[model samples]
Target: MGDIENIDNLLALEALLQVTFHNRSLLLRAITHHSCCSETALRDSYDTLEFLGDAIISAHVVEYIYRSFPNASEGDMTALKSEVVSRRVFALIGQQLGLFPFIRVDIANLRTFNERSRDSLCADVLEALVGAIHIDQGAEVARDFVARAILPMVEQVSVQADTNPKGRLQKIILQRTGSLPRYRVLEQSGRNNDRIFLVGVYDQETLLGLGKASSIKEAGRLAAREALETLQKQRGKASIIDVGDESQPQL
Candidate 1:
């Protein structure tokens, strides 16, 4: 079974988070995935720690935003907190921390999962680490750790949160043309495990773009992104044409 000695990465992470653990075993337990211990019959894993850490992280983030942005309304702060604590944002943070390098996973078939899977795993580890920190130290220490490690990345997270292609296209259409973008299911196919959906985006009576994905939501987002790109290109060309026409001599 793996012990604190097996976790060389913890030392580096300790330096990064700027907090030393009183109980090194707790930190090791925090990073230990169920898969790792399942094979060795080890009782401790990070799942419970992850659950606790998630709650602590949420509370810490909300309180930080609430105090920092006092002039901002509750709804805005809530929206910001939701984005900040999102899985996607946390996964990005994990990637930045190089958490993947420290993860202990099965060596076989590891190459097949791709970067997305690795990112998801790393994100989970980060949450578990937070839980471990809370347990080893206290709520205040965990809060400070989160504030130091995560708060600096809030601006980046906010930018990415707003870049959801579907939402972006919807907002642009509504603001520019005073109309909401619409979606239609073009087709769906395949079985439960590997289903595919094709969807199209429309503006009023006109079809803007079409796309396909494993899920209807993803297909719709893809279609919206395509439409947004097309719209932007058309606008750019129109502007260029207008400028050219203006620059030409009157005949």
Candidate 2:
């Protein structure tokens, strides 16, 4: 709710993060915002740590994706990374960890800002905390922090991917033929901002499915869903739909 400058506050934060800071000043600085600090005292802010934490989180995320998804392509890994390191994801993590209350901000500015702005601020503070942890301890400790706070979300991501039509189709195609399904835009029409895209999905030489949507991604997903349904009809018993009971959203 206020500046986390006191010993008790720092200790509580340490408990929350499950890491004991050798240099407590780093922890204090990580929770302080520049808006709340004077020019002369700006060094007390979390800015520097935020910068460092961005790199720290990114490196760990890339490593995590590479090792966890051994079969995933570079593009796939990158897509997962983008989702994991996204501001929205970080903001959700930050909120869950109660980082917002500890952040020291200019009350006037904070009051004027909207929910989106506050979420961005919370995400920044979360990154700064990661930076501080890295500086105060090391990569191993920072990794522990990430595992505790961020990696749990990886499971959720997996579940989302599992229920995704495109993800399901990719896994099925890859397992059945050891080749990924390809989606190509057959035609695009309408205005630039509100354009329509017709996409076709192929497995090797066969056109498995076709779909039309406003965006390339949506069209691809729809095509994948259609492909899955088609495959199910052809195979009868052995189909991707029978692979799991996970409910997929309609693309």
Clash totals for all candidate models: 0, 0
Regions of candidate 1 where Cα sits further than 4 Å from its true position: 1-7, 39-43, 71-73, 107-112, 159-180, 184-200, 205-251
Instruction: Give one digit per residue, the lDDT tens place, for model 2 in 1-251.
Output: 44444788888888988999999878988988777785834588988889999889989888888888899888778778876887778989999999887777786744456565678888998899999998889889999999889877766876566235788798899999999999999999976545789999999989999989767886887898789889878897556566654566657
Model 2 steric clash pairs: none
Worst 10 residues of 1 by lDDT: 107-116
The global C-alpha lDDT for each of the candidates, from Candidate 1 onward, is 0.78, 0.82
lDDT of 1 at 52: 84
